[model samples]
Target: MRGGPYLLLLVAGTLGVGRGLDGQLGSPCHPSGRCNVRFSECQDNICRCSGTGVPSAYNNRCLPVADGLKGYCEENVQCTVPHSHCRRFSKECECVEGYVMARDRSVCLPVSRLGEPCLERAQCKESTECSPSLGVCVCRGISYEYDGKCVTDHISNNWELTVVTVSPAAGSQLLAHNRWLLCIALAALVHAGVR
Candidate 1:
């Protein structure tokens, strides 16, 4: 009976062989069948997800490919269920309004020109020129608007034309003057030759 006190002290001082207050076996995963390799913890059952699959080191989630699929979320975060898009750099998923998937399927863009209200040159198409007053890009042929209606032409006010007229009477008078001078010169030359 004297050894009973010493044995009790030895059992109390035992290391790594006692059960938790809740009687959990070893770790939460061993008893609950759920493990979080990424977080290195037995799930507290709050966000209960099966950790049986491949473990992810980055997010510590069940799936190994949760972060992204390479270039798809390079600059942007990977798209999640609630978020429309994922931005890789910021690591956030957000919804982009008025922007739809482009033809290439890699980028999201506005549906049409009307979708974006253009107030500057950069917002217009390459062929179009921006008119800030109207807050949109007008095509080359599209006329500018005055009041409420479109003006067919907004030509520069400095344009001018020179009017030229041909007078046959003036031409005939000049021709006669030339003939009189020629005859007088011819007469003088003949007189000098005779001398």
Candidate 2:
């Protein structure tokens, strides 16, 4: 009977001592990045970060970039460019010149998806591809190379590059269009040294 009491006391003491040492009672430091308001615990069962880009912590846990956005990022695998938000249409994260993050985490989406049609190579879906381009899935081609293999280029001209630039007027909307023409014009002026 004395042995049973001693065993119970020992167990209770051990538990009490652990509670004192940890000081949380049961709430430990939750991972910042790992928690999305749904699950806040890092210990028992939590989703681990796994993405090609650099791992980042939000709540307390490290998070990897989301899938389908593999090599289009520089820092946070989810982002194509630094500080840029991931585009759902292209699956590439790019920062538009003027847009900022909204309360719902929505980023600025340009008309590029509507103007230029790209499917398969650039990760653009078939139905989403723009017209006249007859955007169709094809083998990875020219502009971008994946895994030592060059992805296919649906656009025939390399002169076509979509760049988002802020308009001159104050509070003017940003435009996503061909930057090649501007570069060429600038180059011509530079060569001629126009005033």
Candidate 3:
């Protein structure tokens, strides 16, 4: 009877018919077979997939994980999208340098175009400014000004025209200055004629 019980236990163990002595469930998949797919692993004796899990995404069985920019992931490998990386603390995908999170917070988009609304300079395209007053992207430099609709400039050809409103006293001073210049020019001409 003692031998019989031992033989029964041995057979059960060989066949994997019940829990092991440690009271743990046997793994359904072989150790080598487990984690066969990318970003997949045997967790709690079960094969679990990671990442976005899109069709034919991983190992041809589990869904593919999203890329780092927009997908939720636990590891970098789980991110399948380009220019993306996994954030360990957040367990989410994020964009790399030179990319920005879209307004939807799902995908990484390029910086804003000219005249597009923006919250930060990084959100705008290169050499552009996020207009603080209008909250829109605009060209850099003092030449550009935000009108009601679009950005405008005053430069024409190589010369820049500047219009300024002057008080009465300033206007008279400018007129006198011009007159003095004219008189000086006439004197120079007379002196040249005598020479």
Best by lDDT, which number?
Answer: 3
* lDDT, candidate 2, 1-195, per-residue tens: 779999998887655431212322123333332323232233433333333323332433333455332324323445633346655566555555543332233433332332243432333332233233466333222234334333333233333334456558622322225466566755655544443
Clash pairs for candidate 3: 51-65, 52-65, 52-66, 53-63, 53-64, 54-64, 67-81, 68-94
All-Cα superposition RMSD per candidate = 20.9, 20.2, 14.1
State the C-alpha lDDT per candidate: 0.43, 0.39, 0.58
Using all chains and alpha carbons, the TM-scores for the candidates as numbered come to: 0.24, 0.20, 0.34
Candidate 3 residue lDDT tens string, 1-195: 679999988896655422222322222433434444445555555445554453242224554565446566766666665666778788778877767876666556556767887876768775577888999888876435444233332222223233579999988897787988656555555544522
What local lDDT does model 1 show for residue 43? 47
When summed lDDT is taken over every stretch of 10 residues in candidate 1, the lowest stretch is: 16-25
Which pairs in model 1 have colliding backbones? 38-60, 76-86, 76-87, 76-88, 77-86, 77-87, 77-88
Say which prediction, candidate 2 or candidate 3, comes out ahead on lDDT.
3
Tell me how many clashing residue pairs each candidate has: 7, 16, 8
Q: Write the per-residue lDDT of candidate 1 for residues 1-195, one digit (tens) a residue.
A: 999999998776543222222323223333333333333334453322343333333333443222322223322323432325555465544346645443334344342352245544544553454566776656535555444334443333222233446498976775687988656555555544522
Segments in model 3 whose C-alpha atoms lie over 4 Å from true places: 1-71, 112-122, 125-137, 140-173, 176-195
Q: Please name the candidate that would achieve the greatest TM-score relative to the true structure.
A: 3
